[model samples]
Target chain A: MNELSTLANRLAEKGKESGNGFPFEVNPIPGEVEVLQIVIEDREELPIFISVSEEQILCMSYLFKQDEIKSGKENEINKAMLIANISMPLSAFSLIDDQYVIYGSLSVNSSLDDITHEIEILSDNILESIEAMREYLN
Target chain B: MSLITKILTALRGGAREVGESIVDKNSIRIFEQEIKDAQGQIDKAKRDLTEVMAKEMQAARKVENIQADIIKHEDYVGKALADNNETLALEIAEKIGVLQAEADIQQKAQASFENHTNRLKGMIKKTTKALADMERQFIMVKTTDSVQKATAAITDNYASGSSKLLTAKESLDRIKEKQADLEDRLSAGEILQDEFDGTDDLDEKMKAAGIIEGDSKAQDILAKLKAKQG
Candidate 1:
């Protein structure tokens, strides 16, 4: 038994020296779809979110420029959401069963109308995210 | 009473006494012969046991010597490996492996011989017990009959058998030692390598000979040699 232990130790040391490393802390999820969460300080600089299962960047969302949100027409928020939806292949987010939610607030100085428009825009983006996810599943 | 009646009675009495004496003498002779035979058997058994023990001891000594040689070779290999001379180290390692295998084989043979010796010893013990019992019976008969026998049966049996047993044992011991020496030499590479190498056909030969399954190393070696020749 001691001899076996010694051999195991030697092999482990060899493996470490070879520089092959595992990246994620894999855990068993309750349901079929795997989950990944990323937190950022500022929504505008949203980093690319990669799905661990599919090996692709699934979502990229950034805060809209303040001037465009203010000067644009009423449907601008929905347009921005639609653009974000079309940017990525639908297959990228299929691993997420729940609504793919993106949470961020408008700048404090922005008007009530601007905040409302941003919320609407975010909702449109959510719908587009769900549709993209469905396409991927099919 | 009449004189003729008295004379007839006296003659009958004398005849009866003579018959009783003859029967007593025959019983004594038979008992003595039995003791002699039992003693002879004990002697033979002792001799056989001695021979077995001597062989066992000789095999043991040879095994010890081979073990020492193996340790030395192993140490040499370890030193070579430590010195980073991997080529030399590997060569020594291979040699050590072969020597170890030979030592293992000899050890097994030694164990077998020891077991055989033990069995022979058990037989000798039983024979000795029988002889002792026979002696006791003979003494009981002598006391009851008031007969003085001339033969020192016990002493003669022990002396003759023990001496032969000792001599045979010594001879077997020497033979075993020689066998061990030959094995050691083979391990040390003193024997020709070809002698060990040519035994691959052993299985085929064993099959042909109808020796389906048994541990006959000598036969295996012969078979291997034949295979190599072919």
Candidate 2:
């Protein structure tokens, strides 16, 4: 299997052992470098995707599309997210194509526990981040 | 140009054309090529480092050989002086002087070579580290590019279909709902626990009011004795 798939397996096992009440389901996306979609229980709407590179392990989730924002509030919302980015812990905000994404990255050498912690933190951040930007949504 | 500027330029090129990814595969390919070029340069520097080191060793050997010649000639001068041959001793001393001059030249060359070798080695070491750092950055850029493309594809699919894509507001709403649900569950549990604890208190109150029997163990023993007596 690919690097992401292997990481997904490790994360799945970690979820079982942690018993922090949030369960995980990992699904692999076939490609040149495999991507894994990790759906955390109770936070299924914001599923985190894991993308592995040779040097970085990236965990990201999509927030909303640009068109979903109020028409005139695009620039305003961008500034808001940029302002919120600094205060948000462990994750940052970016616009990929047309969708806004929140992501956290670690070195490829990071342990399974660190990766799992990153995922959990990202999952939590997804909600708070979206809520912070809720005023701009349509 | 700086890496950030290069990346931004590539992204700008892709953005001009609609339907193309902002950081398309071509840009990533270019980045990968750049990383490969950096790797090639580091490899060449390593090769050059070895050549410089080899020259340094040669220069050092030449110095050592010149010093040995001067030492051997000094012995000859001493032997000639011991035979009481003044003319022969003077000639040998002159040869020793030539050897010393040659040794000076070789020693200078060896020191220069040593300095150059050290400088080259330091440059190669620094360049190799920088190349590794660039390669790592390239990988991250490539991964982010690929992730963007994948996310775009998924978003497009969802946009074109009847199934609405989940919005930020909706996600936040769901989170709130889950939190509310958890809160409700916790409160319910607390209520249940309170009732459990309150049951003992209620029973004690009832016994005090004589509405329910209390401490019936002694009464049961007395009844058993009465039955035995009868």
The prediction achieving the highest DockQ against the true structure is 2
Error of 1 at A94 (Å): 99
- TM-scores, all candidates, are 0.31, 0.74
Please report how far candidate 1 places residue B140 from its true position, in Å.
3.0
lDDT for model 1, please: 0.45
Residue pairs in collision within model 2: none
List DockQ for all candidates: 0.00, 0.45
For candidate 1, the docking band is incorrect
Query: Which candidate gets the maximum TM-score versus the true structure?
Result: 2
Q: What is the TM-score of chain A alone in each candidate?
A: 0.28, 0.94
Clashes of each: 3, 0
lDDT of 2 by residue, A19-69 (tens): 567678887765544677787877777788877766577788888888989
Off by over 4 Å in 1: A1-138, B1-30, B142-230
Candidate 2 steric clashes: 0
